[model samples]
Target: MKQDTPTPLQEADDSGFAVRVTQSAKSVAAKVLPVSSGATALLFGVVMFLVTFGMVMVFAASSVDSVRSEQNILSVVFRQGLFTFFGIPLMLIAARVKEGFYRRVAVWGVLLGIALQCLVFTPLGDEYGGNRNWIRFGDFVSIQPSEFVKLALAVWIGFVLSRKGGRVREFIPAWIPVAPVAILAIGLVMLGRDFGTVVIMVALVFGAMFIAGVKIRHLLAPLIVVSVVAVPIVLSSPSRVRRIQHFFDGCTEAEYYAGCWQQLHGTWAMSGGGVLGVGLGNSRAKWNWLPEADSDYIFAIIAEELGMIGAITVLLLYAVMTYAFIRIIREAQSPFTKIVTGAVMVWIVGQAFVNIAVVLGLLPVLGVPLPLVSAGGSQTLATLLAIGVVLALARSDRQSSQDGEAPEDVRLAVRAEGRA
Candidate 1:
């Protein structure tokens, strides 16, 4: 063996062979491990990009309306930008807070939301588009308080359900603690006559419970009860009933000039964009043809000006964002982090889908603004704050991982993959 010692050429070949094997093993491992480690950075990047993209889209969609109504073409964009400024800092602050701090204050947050929502019934409350949900802070300034309630409900539900812990499998144990407060939140929003928000709030409650591992039967019971109660409420309103009736008509002539006006125009906007949009700021809908161009139906304008590709890109971004939230949920070590992150995922992303479906006539118009992309300060601020909470959860989860106590789910996943 000593006499047959390998030459430099043999040594080089052996080293290269080891390198090839290592690379091959890594490739195989990469294929086996489909999920990333929480992907916190990806979540933040997607959110920031959406916020910036929303400002740009709002500018494009609101230019005509701003010039027509405000006499200043930049007025709407400037207002939204100001909200962006305010929301970003709140988001950063939220990201720095401890998760346990939110848990301890959930009840107070719900009370605050309820108090603000009560203002909708006060003298300062102003009616807009038939929904008496706005409170004016000044002659030109107003806010929709239900927007804040959306996040508050999520936090409260998580705190209450997580308190149940091992007993969460029992319906009464989980349902009784949060039921009264949940009812009060829903009732206050109902008093404002904003059914769109009511639907979202209902979903938000169920989402928190579901994510916290509450009994499914308990979750389903309330969902069914709410649906049953909502039917007559929908049919009782003549305007809502008309919208429902026209929803199935496919925007025909008889209904087009009446209830389906926005529906038809929104459809036309999407069709005009084709595979690639007409080009940014080139949408005809913003010229007064499609209503709520910068709010509920902004998705239509995005499709119209940017085309199908643009629409797909927006959807892909959301999909990625959703995945990141799910990853956080899976990697989270504490019940609070998992519950809050899941609740936020449902709030912002679920609302976006509903808004898009309404614009495309796939669903009856719900009047909910597109999250992050809509030109409303309240929705934008609340949503950014929610994301901040999510980032906070992510920070904690990452720190926990670095300390070698990986979340149980993640550790199990790694162990299983390693065996392969």
Candidate 2:
């Protein structure tokens, strides 16, 4: 066959395809590249590593349970992976959103979060482990709305406090809409009886407020009120009371088979791992001896299988993440970015601390998952989305700095607003 030269139309078509491909490649590269600050890149990398490690751990920790429950061995990990698949893109999309967009939606986000949480009181509500905090779509799908509530509360607090400027130092101006709305969001979760989440939310609010420059004296009043309120709530539930007593007084012999089962097993798992762990996928605790082996107590599984080295490595990763958040907060031009980043830091890192502490028997069994390392879809997706918001803030600050506007100029503007 003779190879004929292309006609003008064919040549035009080929050129068009080549240009399209080039443009497409550039677009993809733009999305993939870390063209922002070092903090953004570091945060992204740390998150990805945690997520991947979590998936592996979830697989290892959940396999025996899956087999015992007569489900496919891959079922838990596959579900976790599926959420990660969706979450990573959601995170990227969130990172690309403008700060103005978050400000515009902050109030509405809080409202929507509250609405979703309220669904747990309706027929759609589902209960697990004594807390009614989930909305079930059917047998196959259920979501914990409190996870999204934490994000909304963080954004709302940042928006309100940032706008308040120097007024944040005053009581009425600082707490007015922010404190009330936050209380409502947290109270709804409290109604669900998930005190663990409530505790984290409290930390998030205080962290944001402190970062935004609220007076320490003002915080003390609320601190006392929260302490007073928490006591009654803790005493209201017999199970809660028992867990608290077990934490302070230590577990008795009869209680070991009852209320202290999870804690005792968790301690054993941690001790069994020694320094280097038994090796991945070799945890004896996951064989039904430990409750929530893949979620709340996943760190114990890490200890049992990966040992002290693996466990410490995970802690170091979180420490690195904390540093990234601090970098972003320090470099951000806007008060909102700093406040929001601080709130998210407290939420994720504080929750991780709480989870790890519970596993180590320093705290009671709180039923909180290990952030990105747990086998829970809602917790993972919500956490990734929060990180995306922080990334967006970091990139915005980076762009502002690169545009030749000095940090002093931004500070002067804020000071001018405060004077006004």
lDDT of 1 by residue, 1-420 (tens): 468889999999999999999999988854442222437767877888999999999999999999999999999989999999999889878887776688778899989999999998999999987789999988978998999998888887776666555566677777886788888988888877788888888877788788888877878888898889899888877888888888876678677688888999999999999998899999998999999999999999999999999899989999999998888888777666788788888888889888888887888888999888889999999999998888876776666768877544344435544664
What is the Cα-based lDDT of residue 236 in candidate 1?
A: 76
- Model 2 Cα displacement at 323 (Å)? 0.8
* Model 1, backbone clash pairs (residues 3+ apart or across chains), number: 3
Per-residue lDDT of candidate 2, residues 1-420 (tens digit): 999999999999999999999999978866875337778888889999999999999999999998878668998999899999999999998999877789889999999999999999999999998999999997889999999999999998888788767878989988998878888999999999999999999999999999999999999999999999899899999999989889998866678887889999999999999999999999999998999999999999999998999999999999999999999898887888899999999999999999999999898988899999999999999999999999887777777778966433245547768788
Segments of candidate 1 deviating more than 4 angstroms: 1-38, 401-420
Report residue 193 deviation for candidate 1 (angstroms). 1.6
